[model samples]
Target: INGARLIMVATPANAHGDIAEQLAPFLKDDQIIMLNPGRTLGTHYFYNLLEKNGLKANVIVAEADTLIYTCRLVKNGLCRVFSLKKELHVAAHNPDDTQMVCELLSEFYDVIVPAESVLETGLSNLGVIFHPVPVILNIARIEEQSTFSHYKQGISPTVATFLEKIDNERIAIANALGVKVDTAVKWLNRIYRTEGDTLYEALQNNVAYTEVLAPTTIHTRYIYEDIQTGLVPLSILSKELGIENSAMDCVIRLASMLYNYDFYLNGRNEGIIDFQKIINSRKVAISR
Candidate 1:
């Protein structure tokens, strides 16, 4: 880690802060740290952790809106890659470092592209809309250890409809924050080139999701990771901006009840993020 020029943090979102804390002492001014899929506000949260750790290193922190590959471990030492996204949106904690970060990352991945800022990359996180809802709605099968394709069979027409509602709320929150983001339906079309009038149709058309299986247990990253780092932050922003996010709120509450854990208390919230600071930062970035 100390000798690496580029460090990719690929752990679940819930562990990002811990990873930052661990890396703080070893990080150098010239190094670049990237959160593979920052989910939402990941760079901000991670930077805050670095600051709290009293690190003086000027390491460039960057985040991607989503992972570049759809893959799973096939065995102990083998992995199966379903597909690779044609393009990926990436941004740095400091807006000015975005291009350099993208350039550095491009040497390894051609799909890297600069985003407006972390706000754009964070709000553009599609997992917030895609992961938790299906798992929550299909808790029965998951607990029973019933194997099924996550996107294909898990997201039925009705579940997909509910997901669309959640996606709309996510878009509305992003708009309220003065960031432009693609709708989930449009994102599917853009990322997978699948044509559909609705998000469900587009998801159904995505062959990349064909063999993706649902989590076998109730304790999965879809809830702990997505809710903690993705929806929790979005919900917090929605409330701060006075936007109605009952759909998100409901999911958060349901997850809390199912897990017997207070997600808002444990997840990313006012305690971890300075809402006003982030909002002002976005405004400053936009004005430039």
Candidate 2:
């Protein structure tokens, strides 16, 4: 790993803290560690883990809202790339450093647009918005090993309506943090270059996601990882920012009940969130 200036962390979101723990000692100052599509607040977990390890490295950490590609594995060491995103939203732990990281990343991806900060990137997470609800709504199919499309068949009109309220809560939290985030449908349009009047229609029209199917089992990362890591953090920040996220809360509670686990207490922990910074963010936002 010598002479490596950048490390791309593409592991499952739940494993980020553990991976950070192991990679902490080897990271050099000025090196950059990027969480390729940190579900929600992944940079915080990475930055805090490194800091707590006393690495004192001047490394830059960044994250994206979603993966740059719609991809799936064909087999061991082989993968299928379905569609390359037209746009990808990104940000760093330190927002000021985002542009530099974006410049470096543009060489690989089609586009890397700077987000306001890691906070914005985290809140803008599309997976967190898309993954859990559909799985819960279709738990029977997921559990029974019934075959269906994740976006096409899974996200029904009812599920789409439910997700609309959840997405609204997310937008409210973003507003509370003084960050602007597009709603899920608008985000879909932005990234996929697809046009639709509604989210379900847009998702149905997006051929890139059409090939993706539902999980064979209920015990999948869509609920296990997304709720624990993604919704948990969003729930925390929403409560902290005083946004009433009942839909988000209900999802978390149901996931915890179904899985018999407390995601909030068990979710990624390296003491990363630094409540003072959040308070400062509130102050700055209010001032503006």
Residues 61-141 of candidate 2: C-alpha lDDT, one tens digit per residue: 899877777787889899898777777888888888899999889888768888878777888877777898999889888
- Relative to the true structure, candidate 2 reaches a TM of 0.91
Model 1 regions lying over 4 Å from their true place: 284-288
Total backbone clashes of candidate 1, pairs 3 or more residues apart or in separate chains: 0
* lDDT tens readout by residue for model 1, 1-288: 768989998778898978988888877788888998988889878988898887788888899988888777789888888778788899998888899999988998989989988888888888888899999999999988999999999999999999888888889877876889989999889868998988789988999788889998888888889999989999988888788889999999989998999988878889979987887766676688
Give Cα-based local distance difference scores for all models.
0.87, 0.81
Candidate 2 clash pair list: none
Work out the TM-score per prediction.
0.94, 0.91
Alpha-carbon shift of residue 282 in model 2 (angstroms)? 4.8
Top candidate by lDDT: 1
Top candidate, metric TM-score = 1
